[model samples]
Target chain A: MSDHKILQYPKSPYLKTSYYEDTAIQAFDTPFRKKCLVIGLLFWVCFPFVASSYVVHIANLSAIAAIGAMSLNLLIGNTGLLSLGHAGFMGAGAFTTAIMTVQFGLPIWIVIPASGIVGALLGLIAGLPSFQLKGIYLGLSTLAIHHIIKYGCSEYQYYGGFGYGIVLEAPSLGPLLLAGKTVWFFVLWISAFATALLIANLLRSKPGRAWSAIRDRDIAAEVSGIDIGFYKILAFVVSSSLISMQGSLYAYYTAVVSVEEYSFGLTVSYLAMIIVGGLGSVLGSFLGALLITALPYALIILAGLVDLSFAVKEHFSVIQTGVFGMVVILFLLLEPLGLVEIWRRVRCYFELWPFSYKPLTIIKR
Target chain B: MLLASIVVLAGIYALLGSGFVIIYKASRILNFAHAEIVMLAGYLAVSLAVAIPFSAASLLAVLCFCFVLGMSIYAILIRPLAGYSVLSAIILTVAVGVLLNAVGVFVWRGEMEVIPFGWRTYFSLPGNIRLSSIEFATLGIVTLFYACMGLFYRFTKIGQQMRATAENPLLAAQRGISIYRISGIAWGIGFAAAGLAAFLLGINYAISLQIGNIAVAAFVVALIGGLDSLLGTIPAAFIIAATEQLTITYANPRLGDAIPFIIMLMVLMFKPWGLLGTKEELDRV
Candidate 1:
């Protein structure tokens, strides 16, 4: 308790809460939280200008993935539910948007929301079983959902005739063109920012607290009078919506929606992003997506610079996957909280400066 | 011929499904890397066979290599991550699988290799039933492996320890058992079984980087059989395999992969713990 209180500044009115209080640190008056918000906003504003075309592309991709990862974190990280089939929800959104735009000639505004709604509806249906199940059973249930979606999309002729997937034209906002890397960068960033803000605000609300409670200990949360069923479904709905949003964005960015793009491998990659990002942390999701997405491209460029053999270059894809695995394992073994936690530590170190002490007591404090 | 081929495929599924069940039972984590281990073993066997002068010698060498590889994986990966969150362990195993797949692709350059198992003969049976030499060998080897496992568990002291650990690891530890050692042996055995299955599969089909996609059937089989029940795996594997074969042969060839997944979904909806899995075992952790 003393250690928890040590970081609190007595002069700050925001620090008056007892250290044992279970409420999240929501008081924005605190210097740390304020600084973080300011820095984040500044970065968002200037990101497009400062970032190179390749960097912008990576950032856009990361932003979309971040939203998806954040959504998954809500279920897995917050609610303690493991879902192996999230790509199904993303696929639902992607395919829905793809179908609407290509087949039905729907406008982007109508299609995007419809895609999210479709995703939420499917998520609700998939998550309905969670009310009766727990743990691995729940995980397997989601996995089933994943396979069903994959097979349904691939084998069935309803969405698109066999062997042909839906493709969309580049979107435009009224007279303003929203195409290429530049438009996608802005679109994904705005969506990512909105998602982050929504999640951050939700964390401050009662429902979010309920979700966190359910995550830490569902029995205790149930005992505390939280409707376990409602919150659990809500988590799925919200998370699925975000994932679907990402899916819609992904479809537009790539302009093609193929079963190959939404394979189990991609699901694994998304999970890896969440793990490497830091499970429950919003910032961790962004960091993890950036690392996982960029690492391969960076490695490929390095390999090219060294004039690697054709065989080696061909194999580099697998090697990249291996390195991703190794990074994930190393992170789990060394810092389970992930890169976000490491970043926090680095920030704290700089903030504390020369006053940092290495003694057990000081370190713990 | 198709029916016979279906039976052989079912037999292959049973082999892999049993391995998955063993690992899941002894250590309550789905080894996402299980398929990768199979791929690794297949590649290893092919590489070793190519290097060796004598075929029998190469087969023996491959088996020994698989055993050692399995043991090392347990020691290096599973043991350290013991007691961590099941989710973390699952992800870690998946990561390891990715790593193995990467290494395999890096070494093999993503090429499909034709493994020559030195058997091309087919035996005819009643009602147009015909089985290839490799299929017969696979079925025989699988039956022998299961028989050996059943006898080993029934008769051996280490086997009893494994059962105890699987039943209740904490309680087994209280009874002077080294749970870590039991878990290691379980992983070692599980990996070796996967290796054997991969080798058999490679003999029938071409081995490549994408062999892991085929191994996804193991999950459906494992689920249908009850992740904890060895006996259930065989029947479930056969049923799923039969469904896949029938769908492919009659309905649509493209639906072959999708059929197992459909069965998996149906099973999960109706009996999530599986046919043989008890409520207590199913809900643990």
Candidate 2:
């Protein structure tokens, strides 16, 4: 039965593995998979060139969101460590960018990595408590970290005399002024693509396997000689650093760094992205980001179609939040495996075609 | 005066934390929506107080509504989440919190609204400290609530059943006790306690959407007292309230919001099970 299923698809060069060399180990193993990658890349490349500035802006936001979501997925989904301080780390990166560019006039090259380092240090501090705390306790500690970061950011804003927030000029690379939505769409999406590649590669490596082991059962993993503490802390550091870098990019993209923007609500939205997209999957992170980022606009369109009252339209933010909450709840309750599972099922249906049901062998009585 | 403030704040936290502790004791799930419940109760109390002529009647109405709300929340959201991971239940609570907050803002506009439970009177103490009538009332109510809870658990058949379920759900079910109903009652009592505290808080200070943040501080209180131990909530609340007061007085006022969390982190690091909680609880999670 399984053999029949395997023969349904065209034979691919990378389908079989040799003794020393694994062809199936590559990211795009199948020809169809390679084709999907090319098409996706083409679409991403063409998006900003063809779309309106508003649409491009939304895409750029999704790109930044994708980076954060992927980083969070690395922690929550892969490493089995829940973090509520994602926005705190993102805020750290944003503040780092704000101070570095606006105050010291630092180059973008130095600023981005500086933000990551800051996040890494914060991650270390946050991860230190994870040795003793697990499950809900760890999540609570992260929530504390988030509140502390928010408090610190506000105090820093006060001391700097930037009552509102610090603003930055458009970044420059020699003659290239990285300003408009179109430029940002490329910069952000490319960064997101780079992050996705990095994550994909990491997941296939030893550390990734160790992470999965720890996530599944820490005690069993520890008994097997895996350094659970080191890997857990490493997960925090890597994930936080990636998210922090994305935060720096976001600061640049928005041209402002305000403490108000990085709220617990923002963290919840990123969490929604990872969970809704498909936890532990690279492509799911991006898809979730795009969907969540566009959700509010979609709600607005729906509201217009429904001919909602002007007063109802005024409360669009409320409706958006309610819808977001409902979506997260529905996803948690009905589709715990998330959109990726649904996608897989759909793909399987098409691949199987007429024989959608499981294949059966002939039985002679 | 500082001590008086600590006492009052401790009373407030104890009331809030007891509800948190009760729900955790019965269900083995942390109710993140308790904060929303607090906010909603405050709003509901304010609206009810306005609609009803008598203040006491309004309070009763609000408490009854919150009790039913808690039971329905358990039935609709939590009961369905039983088969899922504990994390799912926690996240579902968060989602519920968000939904409640949105609905609240939509109805109440997120603005601060004071509960018009009449004018306050200040009472002078021997040490040149003066406290409001509401503070005294809050303290009295908190004491009464805990006392009632203790009595109820010791004597009432339903409370005994709840205690049995909390101790061992399978055994309780084998004994023909409805664990679901017991859990619902726990939620109801928990919500009612938080609601009463919220109403008292609204009477003293204006209640806004931001007031829900108090639930976080209350969580720290609950943790310090131990998650499942009701007796620990009082001292935990007292400790947290004093620390918060001292920190605000001595350190930067901005640290006031972060102090409870910092303490929470410390408690989490040094004692994952909480100060008064059972050691086995740490391993269970």
Candidate 3:
């Protein structure tokens, strides 16, 4: 009992207990981290200028994927919902933007928000089943919704005489035409950054805490007076809205809205992105989006480097799918926590210096 | 003609859905890879028929191979994931399906092929309708399989042990029953059923990668019949198969693909445990 006195003493000299310390984003919590962030921002800002148009285009695509990935992570990682209908949300946004732009002649700004509203409505419908179903059952219901939405989209195209799908004019924002790789890159990456900041802050707030609580244990959360159904629906609405907005941007970027693009495969890829990135982490979402979006290009380059035979090249899509499966399996089996865990381990190894031990305390003197 | 088609389609759904139900009953995990198993069996039937001299021998070989493959999938991939969340297990099954699909594409080159077993002759029915010989074989095979399974479950010691394991795994294990072995047998039987169904489907139509979509319809069947009850799949399959046929024949051909999903959503909305599924099963999931 006397020895227990030593355990009661302050374990670390650098202990922080302020509310601000608890809620503030960890990336900017320390001076060194802030400096690293500044450097990263500078790199991000200069990337378009330094790289070619094709590279900028890829970056823009990654940024768009990053937005979708982050929103999906919010639902699956934070809320524990496991939705397989993310691509449907994105498609709804794309088609909404298409109809608003082509038929009603609405501006890009108006169309984007309209798409988000449509997404929110759809999210409500999608999330309603979550009240009664949990885990994989909820996922299946979302999948059913996805197929329904896909059918509706295709039927609209078929009836509207756009058999090939609707193509839109380059979107203009007021005086400036929002075309070309450079301008869209800025628009997209900035939106991605804003989304990241928004989600990071949201995760620190009451709703975010409620979402995590529900995700960890809904019945326990219910016992603690949390409205389980409300939070679950809120998660779907928010996630779908963001993903739909990204879809709007995607439609504008590609200048096309087609049902073929929003297949079940697309939803699987986004799921892969969040899972591969680091489920609940914002930075992990960005990393995962970048990695998965670039996987095909990376595979092509790798195939070129290896000088593979023409037979393998002919079946490249098949090989790509096989590799995708292998990557997901390896990640789930070996590193279930994802690329973010790898980054944390590397940071820990460097931060710990010559001491080859993991610190038991959160803070060190 | 409509009745004959409905009967044949229902038989196919019953075979596949019962496979899904058995697996879920044993381990409480949804086997998303069941579709891939069906696809693989079709391909195997096509290729092995060309390689082997005897058609019946090749059919047996395919079933035997699929049984082993199913057990291997359980032992290698799914067994490790038992400790994780059910979502992870589901995702792993999807991933395995993707891998198997890629392998199938690589081996078969994604080409459509006909199964050589069935004679393509049509028998005239009493009402100016024609049923293919393959359709007759399908109905006969489905009936025989169900009858055998019914007797096996009631009388066989291994089947009784499996039933015990499914009812209460902990108590079964305490009584010196090996839960893993029972689960492996369930997977084995499930895969064998899928293989037999795929053979019938390939002979009736043509074998291709697209045949995997049949599993989605079967998935709806499993849900409608209750995921835990094997007998429930028969009526559930009839309901789904009739809905699918009616929609395709009367409503629109395009809506045929979407009809099953629409019914599933409606069922989930009103009867989440399914038409025959126990209420407690919903809470357990």
Candidate 4:
């Protein structure tokens, strides 16, 4: 059933592997994957000098979003559990890191990991209900967490009073000053890459396979002796930890925290990134993050081209909100698999070149 | 005064919550955009009052206009999207909300406006339980609406069809019921109730493009009451309102919004199903 004429390709003159040998069918177990990782690392090392300050800022935002998106992917894409309150978990991490650093004068290293630990603890607590519930009930359960975080941060006097004022000093790792755009860019990328690596490895492990099994068929997985509850909680914890790390990095980058920044809208945006990128792929996470993060800037530039009156410019947020909604709907209707899937198809086409033929059975049954 | 306020808030929430239950039961969709519908109706009411002279005639006109708006939304958006996944429906409703918000901004120019309703002396009980005439009217109207809805569901064939649809869409369809028609009716009723609630809210507070903020409060009320139980919504609404009032009166007023959320979390942790919802009903979701 999986066989197709499009699987064939003209032999590469320079390489031993024939196009007919099914390069696409080869499992992701080549030294090429390692070389790709090395190149990615080299690019990051050189990013500080090669990229402009503004590009570095954008990269930082994408990295932070990637971390959060990766966490969400574990729950939604892998475990088939929906979370509407991921921003809340991120907020928990951010606020924890911020409060510790600002109030107790904790070191940067201590605060960052502390943020992840706090996030993981909160994730586990929040995820407990999933052991007993499924579907919309579980979704609402997570939503309740979001509201709780929002309310707690806004009203609870321990963090800051309900006026929504919370601020933190940027951190410095001893002699290595980790503030400004340069340091933020590197820190966020490192965090994102670490998260991606962890997710990749987890996906290849037993727990990851269990999560997929649960996602595909929970009853079958449970009947097969897989502990559904354990894997669900594990996914939630790992996802939450990554989100918290992102949150900590965000807090340190901006040196401030506001309840408004972690609203349901941010959660929606994160969901959009994953959905638009390709739900289960690591490449999809980064692609969705970069595209979504850049979309608003592109809109702003486009809006600038039109000679709008000052009054209209002030109301630009309304326009932006409308555009955001339109974009989400368009993607939902036109490309639900997101950009990564599209990128994969394009790569496959180019790789096959002259011998490529339409795959007759590629359409979903 | 506090007691009177709680009763009035309870009555209003009961009306809205019952409407939410009816719709959810029939469609199996939570209708997240219900709040946006309420805002739309409120805006329409304001427009009617402005376009026509403010009289008893104008009030009737506003109500009728809102009813039509409610029916039209069902026919246009809700009916077509029926039978899709609950998540897709949710995303669609959210999209509809965003669209409505944009329209509201354009219509109101993002300004806060007061709905003109002539006032009389504030009513009071012997124990110094003062209540505004508007509040009293709202409570009375809410009671009337709930009674009518209860009678309709118990006695009317259309109401029975709606119930059947809610209970089992496939079975209802097999029984020769038009699920679309039932859902459309549910949507209309839901929106009308939300409209009435929004009117009462606007009478007490100024209306703005951000009227959906109140919907969040309503959502918490609905969740606490249990998504399936209309009877449970009244007490849940009162509890939520009282908590907010007390938090403002005694605790820090800034914590008022957080109070409901804290209560929701506590309820969810202990009884993942809600105050009135059965575990079996929740498991299906």
Top of the candidates by lDDT: 3
How many clashing pairs per prediction, in order?
A: 0, 0, 0, 1
Which of the numbered candidates is closest to the native, going by highest TM-score?
3
Clashing pairs in 3: none
lDDT of 1 by residue, A1-365 (tens): 99889777566543456643434545365788899889987987787888788888888888888888889887888778889888988988888887787778888888889988988898898888897778877887888788778777775444357355666788876787678787777788888878988887786688888988888788899999999999999988888888987899899888888877787788888888888888877888888888888888888777867877777666666778888889988987777778877787776677668885642221210
| Tens-digit per-residue lDDT, B185-262, candidate 3 | 889999999999888888777889889888889998998888888898999899889989999999876688888899
Share of native interface contacts present in candidate 2: 0.69
Q: Taking the candidates in order, what DockQ does each have? A: 0.59, 0.57, 0.51, 0.50
> Residue by residue across A271-355, what tens digits does model 3's lDDT show?
8887788888898999899988888778887888897788888999999899988888788788777898888778777878799
Q: Poorest 10 consecutive residues of model 1 chain A by lDDT?
A: A356-365
- Candidate 4 Cα deviation (angstroms), residue B117: 0.5
Residues B1-285, candidate 4, lDDT per residue (tens digit)?
778867876776666676677677777778767777777767777777678766456657656665676577667766655544455556656666776676667566766777778875686679878988888888888877878887888899998898788778899999999888888778777777887777777776767766776677777787788887666787888898888878878887657766777787777777866788646776564
Better of 2 and 4 by DockQ: 2
Local accuracy of candidate 2 as per-residue lDDT tens digits, A1-365: 99999889876653465733451345476677899989988997888889989888888899999999999999988988889889999999999999889889998989999999999999999898878777777888898898889898989998999988898999996688898898888888789989998888788788898999988888999999999999999999999999999999999999988999998889989988987888888888988998899999888778777877877878889999999999998998787777887787776677768875863332210
Whole-model Cα lDDT of every candidate shown, in order:
0.80, 0.87, 0.88, 0.76
Q: TM-scores across all candidates?
A: 0.92, 0.94, 0.95, 0.88
Instruction: Give Cα distance to truth, residue B142, candidate 2, Å.
Output: 0.9
Tens-digit lDDT string for candidate 4 (A1-365): 34565457653443556544432323334666668878877998898789889778888888888888888988887888888889899888888886787679999899989988988998898789888877777777788888778777765434455255467766788888787898788778878878888887788778888998988778999999999999999988988888987888888888878777888878878887887787777888989888888777777889878898886787777777777666766665566667886887886777678985863334320
Chain A only: give the TM-score of model 1: 0.87
